[model samples]
Structures are given as C-alpha cells and as structure tokens.
Target: MADQIDDVDFALAAYRTDGEWVVAELTHDHLEDVDVLSAALRRFPGDTGTLGLVAIDEDFFVIVRVAGTSTRLLLSDVTAADEWELAASVLDFLRLPDPEDDDEPEPAGEVGLLADLGVPAATMAELIDDEDLYPDELLSEVARRIGFGELFDDVVGLTSA
Candidate 1:
C-alpha cells in the first residue's frame, strides 16, 4: 500500500481566513488514512473550516471538510476503493460498503458539502461526472468556484506562470 500511497498527485488543505482563501500543501504522511488527514486539517485555522483535497494516481480524488469535530467527505470514484488503500480507508471512515468489481464509478458522500459556500451540489456533480477530466482538474474547478482558482492552479502547476 506504500506504493499506492505514493501515487498521490497532490494533497492540499484549503480554508478561508479573514475572508481570504489560503491554500497549503499537506504532508504525505496525512495521506495514509482519512482520520489522520482529518486531524491534520483541524490544525488549520479557518472561518468556515478546512478542506482537504487529495488527488490520487490521477485516477480519483477525495474531498474532506473538517469543522470542529465534524467531518464531511467526498470520493470522486467509489470504485477506486478496490485497489487503493486511501480510497478504501475513506469508505471505511464513511461507513460505506466497499465497491464490487462491477460497480460503476461514482462519487460517494455529501455532495452538498460546499452548498452553503456557493458551489451547489449540482455543479459539483457536473464536474465529478465528467470522466475526461482528471482529479486535479475537478479540484481546480472547485477551487475556482470557491474563490481560489489561481492559488490552487499555481500550487498544482496547472497555470503556466
């Protein structure tokens, strides 16, 4: 699973402080498990909460939002649980059943996680449903919607300059 853990393309924690969005790179160690990731996120001070955006192997992504003691999660592709330890851990954390080999790839968890922020669940669903885009791209869109596209793009190297 160490090899798979290393497959993380990027892991970031984003939050709003004094009405401004702050994006920071998360340590790879936090990528080992969902609980650890959540705990790590809580350390960040934010007006709303902390969002952990993790893209793995360019195959799928996991979004975790932590506020106080509450944590909401989203997995871009549930089927990824079959082969990824991190994905599987997300399912376990959510108390969701593991995906079968025949199960279709779909997101799991609260799509409305960012509803109160501005990006409705419908918009998030549209992004997640587009199979052609990579996890980083989808995450970039989310950041863009929430007011930090440039910062996110710069961190992920999606922007040229």
Candidate 2:
C-alpha cells in the first residue's frame, strides 16, 4: 500500500479550536487506507470533531470525521472501490458491498455527516452527482461550504495566488 500513497493529491484535517477553524496537512503515510486515517483524525483536538478530506489520484475523495470514539465516513464515488484500495477499504469499514462493474458512480456512507456544521446531505449529493467536477473540486466545494475554503486551498496548494 506504500506505493498507493503517492497517488494521493492531498490529505488534510480541519477542525475548530477556540471557536476558530484550523486546517492542516495530513501526512501521506496513512493516505492509502481508511483505518490509519481514522486513527490520525482522532489525534487532532477539536470542539466538534476532526474532518479528514483526502483526494486520491484525482479520481475520488473520502471524508472521515472523528469525534471521541465515534467515526463517520463518506466516499465520493462507490465505483472507485473497483480501482482504489483506499475506496475499497472505506467500503469494508462501512460494511458496504463492493460496487459492481456496471454500477454508476454514487456516493456511499454518511453524506449528511456535515449537516450540523453547515452543508446538507442534499447539497453533498448534488455535488457528487456532478460529473464535471473532479474529486479535488468536490472536496474544495465541501471545504468552502463548511467555512474553510481559503484555508483549505492554502493547505492543499490550490490557492490561485
């Protein structure tokens, strides 16, 4: 799985501390698997919880949220499990079946995970349903909706300037 880590475009952890949002880069060491990524998210201190956003191979994105002993996950494309180990791991973690070859791209897991934070599940669904947006762009929209667009862009080197 070490070789798979190189395919990650970016991994970041965002959370609130002292009523302010903090966005920071997450190491690539655990980027290829869901278990270690959840463990890494648990290490961050946050009033609500930690949000883990990872874009892989420019193909799909995964969102993992950790609060105390509770963890939630969302995979941008279920079909990605066919090609990505990380996406497959996420399906395993979520106790979901592996997507079939003929299955259309659809989001899997807790799409409403960010509801309390701001973005609704419906909006998340809409974003995932858009075929034109890449995984990074989808994640960027998520970060923007949750109030950390600029900070997220800065951390992921997506800043225009």
Candidate 3:
C-alpha cells in the first residue's frame, strides 16, 4: 500500500478565463507543493483565477484554488495527513495537525474555500457526506455544479458522478 501511495492516477488543473475553462497537465511527483502548483496555475495563459484538482492512490483528493497570494485548499480525508506526504503538506499549508484514528475529514483552517466562487463549502460538505463515493466522484459532482462537469469527465475519462 505504501508503494502504491507514490503512484497517483490523477493530477489535473484548470482555470476560468473570459467565460472559458482551460486545462493544463500537472506531474504527479509535484503534488505536495502549493508554490509549484500555484506557479503552474499562474502560467495558464489568462486571468489569474485558477483551480486545481488532484487525487492520490484513489484514497483521497485535494482541491486548491489560487488568487493572488492567498491559496485555499480542501482535502477529502483529513486522516490522510498522517500517512501521505501530499496530505501532510496540505495540512501544513493550512497549519493543521494530523488526526487520530477516529477523526473525520473536515476543513481545517477554513470551511468555505469555494463559497466566494459560488459553490458553498456547506454544499460541498454535504456532497462528500457519503463515504461510499470516491474522490473522483465527489470531484465530479463539484465540476457538475460549477458547469464544467462534461469537460472534467471527458478529460478524466470518468462518466458517472
């Protein structure tokens, strides 16, 4: 399981520009760095509004949005912070501590990461409320709500939410 943890299957990024959504590829090895991710998003060739999506070992996921110097994050599983380097880095970014065995996945520093963008964190919390859905499915629902569901599914080859 530890060896498999290093092989992540999805690392995609996109940003809205002039009412258009643009995508760019991100390497799996660099998922732990906000600066690298932010830099990549900033170079997306348009306005600075950028959002990132990444999954690890199909066990957990991350959503990051960057605007100016402020970066926001949402992690699918907070317990992952204790095991995965990527999750640990995310918690570090938000100044959160690793959780105990019974801990639930919740927003650490802020709950409304996407509230300003129209998708409320409360709504997102309700979406992932079901533990049965994988990170991709939860993210799929997120894309659907934000009007990029088809594009996201097409790019990621996932059809169901």
TM-score for each candidate, following the candidate numbering: 0.96, 0.95, 0.86
Cα RMSD (angstroms) for every candidate in the order listed:
1.4, 1.5, 2.5
Q: By descending lDDT, how would the candidates be arranged?
A: 1, 2, 3
* Candidate 3 lDDT tens digits, 44-152: 6546568888877677888888777777788877888877777777888888777888887664544577776667878877866778877778777887777688888
Q: Is candidate 2 or candidate 3 better by lDDT?
A: 2
The order by descending TM-score is 1, 2, 3
Name the weakest run of 10 consecutive residues (lDDT summed) in model 2: 152-161
Whole-model lDDT per candidate: 0.91, 0.88, 0.74
How far off is residue 30 in model 2, in Å?
1.9
RMSD in Å for model 2: 1.5
Comparing 1 and 3 by lDDT, which wins?
1
For candidate 1, the TM-score is 0.96
How well is each residue in 3-90 modelled by candidate 1, as lDDT tens digits?
A: 7666889999999999999999998889888999999999999897899999999999999999999999999899999999989998
Once model 1 is optimally superposed onto the true structure by TM-score, how far is the C-alpha of residue 115 displaced, in angstroms? 0.9
Cα lDDT tens digits, model 2, 1-161, are 57687788998999999999999898888675888998998888899899999898988899999999898999998999988888999999999999997998888999998998888999999988888988878888888888888898888878522
Report the Cα lDDT for candidate 2.
0.88
